[model samples]
Target: MSGLPDILLAAVTGFGCALFFSSIPVGPINLTIINEGSQRGFKWAWFIGFGASIMEAIYCALSFTGFSSFFGNPGVKAVMEVLTFVFLLFLGAKFLFVQSVNLPATPLRAAAEKIEARLEQKLHPRSAFLIGFVRVMGNLGVFLFWIVLTGNFMSHDWVADALWPKAACVGGVALGTNAWFFALCFAVSRGHGRFSEATLLRLQRLSGVCLLVVGLFDGTHIVWQLARHRMALTS
Candidate 1:
């Protein structure tokens, strides 16, 4: 069908969005998911990634359908942004505080030992699914990103005429976006044995800091947007 290309393009867009968002500061959740899945199998990694993609699809749908507008209210957005920033700052501090000397013994080289000990026990399938679900839900960065993308699409002049096609494109983007995170986790986890534990810990810390920075930036942006909206309304 001629519509297929549109759908594929949409999927690629979604993938790119997800990749860009996830590539930023890594976090325990993503890293853990990757490491766990790597320990288990690539299929599990794929499943987790797929599950995350589905969540993104739901959010995208909500944004496109105008349901996201309820939360998009200037006041609400401002509050959420502040909360996200504070959360990130707190996480960053925690990462900075965690001493690396407390890890258990492992055959992995010192570089890898740190990470192996930091890794939580293997995650069950149900747990992984739930984690994937929660991660998507709590990930304000990704949520806002999709919301913006969907909003832009909806505002277009052709939105009404090409509703179905546009929707398909958004869905595709969601799938593509999520695939990257899942793939990363699977790949790293599979090869974790080859890396030093210390290297793993360092990676985790780096990811934590990255998330914190993103959270701060998002929070500030939301606040500024709210202020501008207030000024305009009063004027």
Candidate 2:
């Protein structure tokens, strides 16, 4: 409506964009969540998403609220890049070497029965939340990602400059991200029985390999660029 406040419009639209971005099937974290949901129930899945959403909100706020410039510093950038690289490598190794999550995909009713029969292996609430938080944080440099995302929105005139609207947009990012994650969890929870343990293990290893390759390439590129920049400055 024409009567809609500019900030509200930006926030709403920005939220849609963030939701789409979060749903993009790129990251290991999403795969992990799906696997978790497919094995555990929806409660476990949602808790993981909740933790991830919190971090996503924090970063979105930082990027949109002028803290992005602070992270753009060379030292900070380097540190984030290095940490991401190391974490990705370690995660990949863990995926390759550790016992994969191989829970049998029983029907929801059956899963509940089994849980009553014994302890459930699905991530519990506290574990899921903390794990999700740690997993999201491992994908460092998301601050720059949000900055670029918001900058593009501004460039395209899809966003407003006012403070409240910007905050709203950032909140939307978290909401959108959480929404997508919840949707993913819902889908997985419904079909958890369809996934065989072999299938789950294969997917896990595949995602791990993908993460490793992405980290190696991206991490090295960042290091190379930093080195070149330093050499140029010194020369």
Q: What is the TM-score of each candidate against the true structure?
A: 0.49, 0.56
Q: For residues 83-200, what per-residue lDDT tens digits would candidate 2 score against the true structure?
A: 6667667766766554656333336435444543343235333488877765555454455567656654553345565566677777788788889888878878998836565666
lDDT of 2: 0.66
> In model 1, which regions exceed 4 Å deviation?
1-12, 25-29, 67-127, 138-141, 153-161, 193-235
Give the poorly placed runs of model 2, Cα more than 4 Å off: 1-4, 67-126, 193-235
Best by lDDT: 2
- Cα displacement (angstroms), candidate 2, residue 86, comes to 27
Between which residue pairs do clashes occur in model 2?
none
Best by TM-score: 2
Taken over the whole model, the C-alpha lDDT of each candidate is 0.56, 0.66
* RMSD per model, one decimal: 9.9, 10.8
